[model samples]
Target: MNNSIDTKRIVLAALFTAASFALSFIQIPIFPAAPWLMYDPSGIVCLLAALAFGPKLGAAVAILSWLPRVFLDPFGAPMGMLSTCCLIIPTAIIYAKSGNTRAGSIAGMVFGAALSIVAACALNLVVTPLYTAVTMEQVAGMILPILLPFNTLKMVINVVAGQVLLAPCMNVLHSSKA
Candidate 1:
């Protein structure tokens, strides 16, 4: 029985991780000011994985999902992976702690979104200067104007999409267990 459950978890994780990686390729540039800072729906899959399984699994999926991008964009990919984990882990943890209620999901999503934005901003301040020609001051300047809005939008999209699909996904998973 334990082995069966483990196998199911492994299969689910693999599927979610693959879905996230594939979704990462579909980037939508919402903010004109920072076209390079595109939003990918990969985080939604990570959020779903986290909410379904656990934070550790969610974080694992988040990191694995961005691994391909690491080869493609070494410096930028790490930032994306970090920011994604920031969003997934918190949401999973908070939701689990809050008894898995709808309110808990809301709280978790809001908290996770805020944290992801803040972490992305801080990472930009430190790492953006290293890869890009942008200085820390310039990055700081763009925080309020560009980074904040872009990250916020990204999180909002992820949260909304995750919420919409979550109940159905959960139902399917539960039924499968039976």
Candidate 2:
């Protein structure tokens, strides 16, 4: 029985990783001002895994999902990974700590989204200048106008999507034990 459960977990983790990797290809330009900042639903899978399994597995899936992108977009991939982790880890931890209540889920998502936005902004200030043609001063200037809005919107979308899909995913994943 323990072996079966472990097998199920491994299978589910692989499924989540594959699904997230596939979903990363389907990007939508959410913010016109920053077309490079596309919205990908892969984070939804990470959230589901986090809520259903745990933060560690969620992070594992996030890393696996983002790994292929490292070759495709070296800088962007790391940024995406960081942002996704920032959004998911705190969420999973807080949700678990809150006794897994509905209110806890909501609070967790909110807090995670806020942290993701801040982290993205700070990362942009540092990393963007290193990779892109944008200077640190320019990146700082764009923070309020472009980065904040884009990151906020992206995080909001991820959080809302996670909320909408969590119960259904949990049901499918046999998340009663989660």
Candidate 3:
């Protein structure tokens, strides 16, 4: 096996991942949605990691971030487990290349939200058939009604919240020289 990730990268990713998990506990109920798809600045941290490092770091931060959440509160169902992996990596990658400037982060977030919508659509298709009690057609129909819109909402929420909020937070962290 060729295991070659740098130690500093892993440590950073672990820190980011831990931050991601910790952020979940500070929840604000968004409505009737269970587990209430949230606005986590942690995504900002994950995005920052990918921005500072690269996709490998992004994936590590993303996957590691979700593991504890799954054990703690697997939302919607088992199928939704993969949704975590699906949503954040694209967000991470988008943020990484664009972090060269503030405008770049905004542009990347717009693109990232669109990417998240696509990933969410695909996850619905792949997971719904296995988990839903209805026929595949019914599952598709029922889920499409909520899944697409909720995902779009999630992406947009992430993009807007991440850009407006996480950017400043990240800036403060980076500027502190800690």
Candidate RMSDs in Å, in order, are 1.7, 2.4, 4.6
| The best candidate in terms of lDDT | 1
Compose the digit string of candidate 3's lDDT tens values, residues 1-178: 1347666556766888888767756665443453444444455556666655555766577667766766665543233334444455555565656645677667666666666666666665666566456466664674556666666666666667666665566675467443
Number of clashing residue pairs in every model?
0, 0, 1
In candidate 3, position 31 carries an lDDT of 31
- Worst lDDT 10-window in candidate 3: 75-84
The Cα local distance difference test for each model comes to: 0.91, 0.89, 0.59
CA deviation > 4 Å runs, candidate 2: 1-5, 175-178
Which ten-residue region of model 2 has the weakest summed lDDT?
A: 1-10
Please write out the lDDT profile of model 2 over residues 3-63, one tens digit for every residue: 2448678888999999999999999999999898888999989988888778999999999
Better of 2 and 3 by lDDT: 2
Candidate 3 residue-wise lDDT at 144: 55
> Which parts of model 1 have CA positions greater than 4 angstroms off?
1-5
